[model samples]
Target: MTTANNANNNLSPWQPGQSGNPSGRPKGTRDLIGYVLETTDGGKELIDALLFIVRGVTPNVVVQKGTRPRKGQQVRPADQLKAIEMLLDRGFGRSPQQLDIAHNVSSRPLEHLSDEMLKLLVESARQLKEGIGGGYW
Candidate 1:
């Protein structure tokens, strides 16, 4: 029986300007993984593991409590390449990709074109649609 306005009003307890969480996530609050990496030995271990992978060596890191230790296996060339890429990306940010885009299409407003130009444009479009002339489209 509640109207749309009443439904919206009940959705939020705070007033318009008031924030639901006034003191948004404590300034130094970090996620578990980030905290472990920053404060504990995990960060160094992670870098070491990445280096080991790059070098085709199986790192002696425990996965589960009861599982048998992993035997040294030849790391795939693709995997080693990926590890190298990850390390480079983390150490010195990912390389910027260069994109070459060539735009040849005209985007002039219809009103800006002369009557004769507009007619020619329409004829060209009609020809293109009918498979008469060579066009990119």
Candidate 2:
């Protein structure tokens, strides 16, 4: 059995009043892209444009494929199904998958039956086995 050292395992353990990752990013620090965007003057405008695109504040226009004119056609509003899937995965997690079951089954022994009954039981068992391409008794 392999024993791992928790302190040296690289993940920061919880402390009483401190965040788990004290050595990592500070509390108010944004990610690199976010920081860059927030710092830039045109970032707000760019973000507004993206928001408009996502929220359909403005219409979606895509060019029609395989045409000489290739004129722009207005598309339907975007569905946020991927966002829902991401949120569901992060919040409640995914569900366990069901297993496929084989149809093979077994029956009890015929030792307690009478001699005639035992003969009939054997014959019936044989027929059942043959019907299902046979398996062990």
Candidate 3:
């Protein structure tokens, strides 16, 4: 179709990691986190969960009026994930049975699912974002 051709023509010069302008962020500086899932369903679920937390509550965002945005709290995703896992382990005895039991019935033990997990859940709500395609930012 002519429309498809026009789209391709518009995109022809813009290859991945290519800039028409020579100056940019430079190589290896940009950190892009992409998820590889075993199944589409698994991928979707992960994406959904991430989206949910991001949209619902962004703990890092400090509401300020008429001022430039402040630097966000610096924490690597891997570190955050590890902290969450550790907290879950500490709170609910690192076992499938424990997790299942906690989920099936509310208990004081499950209250300790780590602040990080709660933050992630709030920041990334399970809904597609506008313009950025799918998943939470």
Q: How high is the CA lDDT of each candidate model?
A: 0.79, 0.53, 0.50
Could you give candidate 2's per-residue lDDT for residues 1-137 as a string of tens digits? 23466546767667789866667876556676677676655365544434444553443322265433223533234423443444456558875544454744345455656899878768877975785423434
Which has the better lDDT: candidate 2, or candidate 3? 2
lDDT of 1 by residue, 25-111 (tens): 887667866887875486988888889889998777665876644686677889899999999999999876654548544666679
- Give the clashing pairs for model 1: none
Worst 10 residues of 3 by lDDT: 96-105
Q: Estimate each model's TM-score.
A: 0.50, 0.24, 0.19
- Give each model's clash number: 0, 0, 16
Write the candidate numbers in order of decreasing TM-score: 1, 2, 3
What stretches of model 1 exceed 4 Å from their correct place?
1-31, 38-42, 105-137
Q: By descending lDDT, how would the candidates be arranged?
A: 1, 2, 3
Q: Write the per-residue lDDT of candidate 3 for residues 1-137, one digit (tens) a residue.
A: 69989888776566897768878666644432232454336456544444433344223322375553345544456645755665567558875431122354244464777899767645555433442224433
State which candidate has the highest TM-score: 1
lDDT agreement of model 2 with the native? 0.53
What's the CA error at residue 42 for candidate 1, in Å? 5.8
